[model samples]
Target: MTDGLTLRLKYLCGRYWRLLVPVLVLLSAIAFAGAAAGVTSDAQPQQTTVETDSMTVETTLSTEATVTGNTTLYEQNDTLTNLPVYLRSATPEVRLIAVTTTPPDRTVSVTQQIVLRLSATRNGEVFWRDSRVLAADSTNVTNGSTQTTATLDVQQLARERLAEVRAETGNVGTVRVEVETIAVYQTDAYSGRTSAATPVRVTERAYELETPQRDQQTNVTTEQQTAAGGAGGAGPLSVSNGPALRDLGAGLGGFVALGLAALVWLTSRRIGDFDTFRQRYERVRYAEWISRGSVPATGRHARVPVETLVDLVDIAIDSEKRVIYDVSKGVYAVVDENLMYEFRENNDGDMNEFGFVPITEPTESGSTEKTSSDDGAETAAAADSWFDADTEPPDHDSDASPDDGS
Candidate 1:
């Protein structure tokens, strides 16, 4: 509007610009650090959760006995699970069925084995025990979708322990019949999974004493019974160890604040020199080595994020190789080859200091052109004439040497 107003405004800005510039810069840096930390903290856990879910497996013991019709599990994968373990009585005629159905991906042969262990205890003292690998037939899918079935007859097993097991039930206290059904599966991919059905109690029912029939009676060995009780099998399904997605989203707001504080510490604090970076990078490399699988491999010459590479010089020292930083590409490379191959004309000995000496040799390129006019005088004249336009000529009219021969 007015010249006086403009001049006063410009004077005020000029007087306090030095102080104003630093304040603006500090505020801007704080804002950037807060935004970046908040975004990264919120995003990382969600990505980790999705990856964990894909690799998780969960197995549980189903209580229901009625076989739901042939079900398709993991469509395309065509997962076929064996019958859930059931209560096996010593006396009663137990007819158990093991049906092997066709899975979608049966190009590879798969087999499932279910073992039933029976133990009868009187007053918490086990007197008799017997285990049988239930009759199971798992054939490779050769032609089309085919099914194989095997029925386990428990009557014969019961007859073997007729006297020992039945006598325990007639005792005064609670007679416990602990039946454990464990299933083992092998896939075509050479991987396997072992699952144990919850131990079913077959106690309350009375055992009917029938006429004794002669059969091969292999007395249950003492060690075999002990091994069966305190079994150290595969650990629980890994899927249970995965972090719950519901829990991942919790306290994200708090994490944002914590991450912002960390960002401030990293940004505002004085970043030490190359030696400091070198030490920090060495520590990071050691941490990566100790926890190998946790840190994914970064490809050659990849631009590392600030989160990964705290100080550039630290990475250079940790690698102990020639580190090349391309500011435009925003990537760093640790190379063993000499990079000054094209800069052979430098007279300074700096290149030699780095162990790069120019290798002078006959040119590999094709023959050079020969001049038609082989005249040295003409060549000299052409060189002088080329620079004649840019060079100033010496005036003959000025005092030439001392006007006369002194």
Candidate 2:
């Protein structure tokens, strides 16, 4: 029995040997592949970390400044307070007469007169100074007159003298005068009061001679000729009674008269035309027609009623009186004078006749019925009663004919 069992076991072992060999080979190949993969993973390259040095820098800046100034100028005198001394001439009619430190010539002394009065105040007391400085030509003077008069020629004085007077008196403000009086009255006197006079004016007196009269004999001759002409022959060719001159005069007069008539006729015609045009253009209907054609039809399918279209341009009614057009079927319509005046007085002169009115569609019976349904039962009954009263019932017995008559 042992021998038989050994034989069976050997047979079974031989049959399975082929399969076991392939299984063992596959296990060996998987082991080798796993080992190769493990080796490759472990031998892979690694990244390297490199080290570098860091650097820093510093800088500085500096600045400097310098200044210097020194100059000198001549100073002016402060004796005068620089206050303006307004110098005004005696009259605006006269120009500058003369300005001088010394007296002027004889030719310079006839045109203008300069007068001066001087007074002084020392401490708290007041005293009158030099009262008179007469003209070089004047001889009468014995003092105590508080006024001095000096005559000077306007064109004879040098310009330098005027400048010196202006600078000394500080008359840079304004210069004005009446006759010949001091412009600046000294309110505070004392500490060396001083003033220089500068004359300025316009001369108004006439210097030319009058026109001479003609001799009596010459005047008489001219008057006799003028009288003779006025007595009979008054115009050109009046003494000559020739046919040519008469005909020419008559023709000129006729031409002038005809020209005047023509002018009058033309002006009247123009005025009439303008009146007509204004009446036509100023009417509302005409203006609208010219600007837009006639009023549009009521709708795309609706025809505009002839009466309605005509009524659009027709005059409005107000009371029972009818205002008809003065001209029948005329394009231009003018308002009656009385009506125009009344409208002007009442409506502030506006002539607008045709005003705007809105167009609306008529309500349908179905809509009225729907509206009645929406209203409460009480309102519907009241509406029905009102409608029944407004409408009369048709007579049914009137349509029946009499039997005996038939």
Candidate 3:
């Protein structure tokens, strides 16, 4: 039985071996492929999930400043007539007192006089204005011996006087105060001018008129009557029985007519005179004149061709030595020697061109021997021949000699 079982097992294992081997091989291959795929993927650049961020920011700030102080700018006698002139008494009561100042400790000390100006106005017109000096009394102050306060009584008297003046005028106005202190000198003590010091603070005040209400009303009524009178026959536009208007109109009309006549006369005279002058002066001709030495025998009565004359003139011949016979002035002067030479040379070839060289004077025949016409003709003919030459390619070699170059 054992023998039979073993044989049977061996037979079964042999039969299934093919299928089992193939199954194991397939499993190994699958594992290897998966590993290879993973390695390849790792080797390739990774698509990293790199997160990017963006943000906005802002900021703000501020600051502050401050200042403070108390200082004495200027000080004057309090009793001075600070009141408006119109409010001050008419009688000159307030006199300037001595001015003085205490020596300053922490700050500087300055003493100045306050100037007051008094004026009166009537019917909107200033009839009077006067400058009054008010000084300070400095009896108590040491060092600064020129400072003092004005008396109260005097100030009161000034106010009273101003009040009286205002009451009488019935048209009180404001008083202007201008204060300026200059350097004080011992020599200027007696001079009417103010001594030097710091400038004083200027102040102004207006004094009301004391006219009664009834009087004001009456004045208004009078003003209205005057205005009404001015608006009527006596007004600026009112026509009087005189001939002023008629005369003005007549004069204006006469002025207009005279202007028109003068304009027409000027226009006609300008046109007529221009036409007459144009007829008399319009002519075309050349002029040549000679002065100084008499004309040369060869050049006497030698009429320069218009072409030659033009050439001579282009050379700037001296007017005094030039003779113009073509028009206006006839043989009036001698021809410029330089201009004559230029003309002769231009007509004839240069001296070097001819075998006969130039001499200071004309040839014995009194004429240039060098003839330019033949040379000019030859040059012109050569130019024409060159222009007419054919532009075709030559039949000979380009580098050939003259006989062959042609």
Candidate 4:
């Protein structure tokens, strides 16, 4: 059984050697890709983080006010402190604070300040603006210090600015009023590294020129970032994961397989089936004599089968007739008196031949007379008579004859 299988395999390889070429090339490419992937995955660099000492500075903003009124909602000496919705009557005091933390055995000198600004904008453009340095301080710290505070009386400042702007413009039509505070901190570390932080708060309130109106809204404008710097006073450290081994292998295999598939396709296109090439070559060579149509089945003539198209053409030339080729049936024929000489390409060894015996009848002279039962007999007789007459045959001997060409 092994010997028989070996022989069968050898026969297939010999018969289809062209197909094996691309298969071998693909296998080689896959091997090379796998090796390359293994090497690259081994040599790939790993990610790691380095540790060192660093410093950080943190800051916050707050508010303080005394609420005094005769109404039930407002009481005397009632303090309104910290975040939003502070009563505009309280004359809210805005405070800025900062703190610094450093590594062990390190000291940092800090300078902090709070700044206040009052502005009015018309059509989104600032028309009147004023700024004041509400408070400033300096300190040195090894760990962190208590609250570094600077205060601004925002309600009083906004009231004064509103009166001034209204008086200058005669009427405040759709003018937006705003009060803002900025807390800034600068730090100088022992290693000569310096850093700064600026956090902002904005306050908007409704008011008349002479009276503080409804409650105020305060918002922290800066996106809070808790940590400032990386270790060793560098920028923030980052680490990323590299490609996994299995993923690398799969990607390499896919790329090589795609390339090999393309190669196989090109090879198959360039080197086509030998028999199909012969058929196309014959068609092109004999295109002048060949017409695309169906040939009728012969029943009144003896069939004489030939091997190639050249034999059929030779027979047609000798008989002084044109060749009829049926593309659907893959047949070429030339009809002479009682004989139909046929030629067909044996592509799969199962092509049918025109082999029907002639139809005959007894005449009164006791002799056999061959005849056709279809109306095609009249057409054939007319065509034969026309060919025999002075009507010239087709110009079958043109310079593009298949005899001297492919």
- Tens digits of lDDT, candidate 3, 215-308: 0000011111223212222322235512233334444554554454444444334333332222111111122221112234434444443334
Could you report the Cα RMSD, in angstroms, for every candidate shown?
A: 32.1, 52.1, 46.7, 17.0
Q: Stretches of candidate 4 above 4 Å error?
A: 1-20, 23-27, 30-34, 37-56, 74-76, 90-106, 150-155, 158-161, 171-406
What TM-score, to 2 decimals, does candidate 3 have? 0.18
What's the ranking of the predictions by lDDT, best on top? 4, 1, 3, 2
Ranking by TM-score, best first? 4, 1, 3, 2
Cα shift from native, residue 287, model 3 (Å):
22
Q: Give lDDT per model, in order.
A: 0.33, 0.27, 0.32, 0.47
TM-score for each predicted model, relative to the true structure:
0.28, 0.15, 0.18, 0.42
Per model, state how many residue pairs clash.
1, 17, 44, 0
In model 3, the Cα lDDT at residue 350 comes to: 29
Better of 1 and 3 by TM-score: 1
Write one digit per residue (lDDT tens) for candidate 1, span 304-356: 34333334335545666333322112233333333210101122221111112
The best candidate in terms of TM-score: 4
